[model samples]
Target: MPNLELLAPLAAALLAAGLFAGLLAGLLGVGGGIIMVPVLYYVFGLLGVDEAVRMHMSVGTSLAAMIPTSIRSALAHRKKGAVDEVMFRRWLPGIALGVLAGVLTAAFVKGPVLMTVFAVFALLVAVYMAFGKDSWRVASELPGRLGQTIMAFLIAAVSVMMGIGGGTFTVPTLTLFGYPIHKAVGTAAAIGVLIAIPGAIGFILGGLGEPGRPWGSLGFANVVGVLALIPTTLLAAPWGVALAHRLERRWLRLAFAFFLAATGIKMALSLLGA
Candidate 1:
């Protein structure tokens, strides 16, 4: 067991992170993994986790937490009839396969390399969110079989690398293809569930036998983090869904963009050891 003195503060931090992550998931369809991964990295560092496995543990733990968070957010969206079940079904298989591939890759890749990739991708996502117009259309509707397979695989692979649910890419892709913003956000929440399940499992398998893991860890996923986060995330997610239904679309986009950009910058600065 961790020292009581240390564990108390860590629990508090995890709870706070969970609250914010849940809100982001419901409001932006982001699955909260983006926020959780970095937060976990810092927390694990404070606990003196080994540098070699810190990022891996963080990413894996984020994916595990997202399982429940995504489920809550998805159900909330489904209640509002915002989810597109058909699209989710169409994308599921490809995304699952991609996540498996990502797992294999992550098992061998070094931590710094993964962090750099995540930072760069996050920055690109921020740029697109900030400047990309809603009127942009890649197609009138979702692509056919070949295109769907390719895009879904790419989305899952990148999301796995970043320890994020697919929403960061999925919502934008859907919107670009002319889906309504609300519907896209809702659907993305559902997609998060798909990503989190396989993604978390992959991380667990990948991290098996790794040394210097925090106590109460199962593979790369930390039980302590998951336990601390899940309850708060479950409670907060519904509130965020409520807020999302009320917020204006433009304001939501701006807020999401700002958050992404800030996080991207923070990660980038870490690369420079700033």
Candidate 2:
């Protein structure tokens, strides 16, 4: 017997967030976890959920909501021949295992510790996106297949722990290894599916026996939020992928930089009581 009126505002928030998330996902190959995570943190705060559960819920919910959006966007990119299936096959195993480890770590970590880690990581990503080099193409690539495999492992591990789909690091890493921006983003989009599937499952498993969860939650995944968002995201993601094809490499890099900076500031502020 919840008040339907209150759900109106929550529904609106979810829709708006999902719309933006879809755009970001399609355009930049990001999973929108960075954006969704902080927003969910604040929203859950208002709902009086414990801070301990807030981050887990936010991360899990974002991963769940990202599934359809990523799928739609990936398909759009695939249609354009932008996705590198070979790269995806190389990275899948690592991303899957990494995401599981990440979810388990998040579930076990103390709340304050997790928040602090998240804040630091956010700041670093923002700074990297903002001031770091933007060559947009890596030449004289890293050694052999072995090097690439190691890189995949590291990227997956970090992405899972942070609840990101690995784009924040993946695109730049690829660029540094001689890949162009468009290919990097397209490949990253495809990799998102690999990350989300297992990450979502991990979240569900980790939260299954947790206590005092709100109704309408599926483990840590918020069913209400997911249902409200998936449709909007599915509809918007294709448009975003189309738009991504129109943007030049320079513009795309700048846009992603701005996004990372904004996400970082928002998270840092919340953590700092600002």
Candidate 3:
């Protein structure tokens, strides 16, 4: 077990991160998994866990927390006339299988490599979302089935590599393709559940099979970390939704872009040790 003092800061970080993630979700209509994954990785690294297993715990724990958070956000969005159920249904199968594949693959990758990959993705996405043409379009031109399937596959592949829930990629992709931003956000939130449920299970099963690793971890997921994160995120998620309902979305997108840039820079620096 980690020292109580260590756990305190971690607990505080989780709470703050949850609230922050909620605000980002509600305000930007994002799934919050993008921010949560990197934060988990940073916090876990600070706790002195073995580098090799850090990415697993970070990705798994983020998915665990996201299960409840996404549900809360999705419901909130559904209430507001966002979240396209039709799109969600179409994407389920691809999302389900892809997430499982990502988690299983992560169980075997090296930590530095994972971090570097995450950094690269974050850096690219941040740049694109902040400056890309499709950053916030009101209409998409892609066929519904093809777009959802492609996104599901992309989300699963990226989540495993970067510890995200595919929101950063999904929301923008959907919006660019013609879905309303709010609908895209809500749909993205629903996808988090698909990614989290299977991913969390895979982490647990994988962790159990690893012979020697840091104590207090269940597979690649840390029991301690998951337990610490759940409540605060659940509570904050709805609050974020309420806030989202109140804010002007253009400003919110700007805020979301800024947050992504900050996270990307931090992750890049961590990988480069600068």
Candidate 4:
């Protein structure tokens, strides 16, 4: 067991991260994995976890926590009749396959490479959120079956690599294909479940018996982080959904955009040894 003095601050930090993650999920229709991954990375680093496994552990733990958070966010959106069931079902198989492929790939990739991938993707997401117009459309409707399959695979693979649920990619893709913002958000929440479950399992199996993992780890998944994050995220997610229903969300997007941009820049700087 970890000493109480050390565990106390760690728990506190995790709780804070969970709170923010839950809110982001509810408010932005994101799975909060993007936020949680970076926070976990920093927390693990502070605790002196081996750098080799830190990013993997963070990614795995974030996905584990998202299992519940995504469900809660999805249910909240469903209550408002915002989810599109047909689209979700159509994309499921491709997403799951891609997630498995991603997990296998992540097992062999180094921490810095994964970090660089995340940083670049996050910066792109930030740029879109900050400046992309809501009225933009890439098509009159969602893609045909073949196109959707390809896109779904790509989205899941990239999401797993970045340790995010699919929203950062899914929402924008849906919207660009003319999905209503609310429906896109809700559907993304549902898709998060698809990405997280297998992704978490793959990470667990991939990292089994790895060296120098943090205490309370199972494979790459940090049990401590999952336990501290899940409950708070579940409780707070509904609150964000409530707010989402009642508020203008432009400013919230801007706020999260700035946060993501800063996080991306920090990770990029770290990668460049700046």
lDDT of 4 by residue, 120-188 (tens): 999999999899888999898987987898889999999998888999899999999998989998988
Candidate 1 structure lDDT: 0.88
Q: Find the 10 residues in a row with the least total lDDT in model 3.
A: 133-142
**Across residues 61-103, which tens digit of lDDT does each residue of candidate 1 receive?**
9999989889989999999999988888888888988888888
1-274 per-residue lDDT for model 2 (tens digits): 3457777787789788878778778877776766677777767776667777777787778888888777777788888888888878877666766776677777788656556666677777766666666564456575466667777777766666566677767877887877766788788888887777788888888888687565688888888778877877787788778887786545655665676567667667766789
Residue 143, model 4: Cα distance from true site in angstroms: 1.3
Each model's lDDT comes to 0.88, 0.74, 0.72, 0.90
Please give the lDDT score for candidate 2: 0.74
Model 3 misplacement above 4 A: 132-140, 209-213, 250-252, 272-274
Relative to the unseen true structure, what is the C-alpha lDDT of residue 262 in candidate 2, on a scale of 0 to 100?
Answer: 72
List, residue by residue over 77-115, the lDDT tens digit for candidate 3. 888877788878888887877876787677777777777
Each prediction's TM-score versus the true structure: 0.93, 0.89, 0.88, 0.97
Measured with C-alpha atoms, the lDDT of residue 24 in candidate 2 is 75
Candidate 4: regions farther than 4 A off: 1-3
Q: Which number leads on TM-score?
A: 4
Residue 54 lDDT, candidate 1, scale 0-100:
90
Residue ranges of candidate 2 with Cα displaced over 4 Å: 1-3, 136-139, 248-274
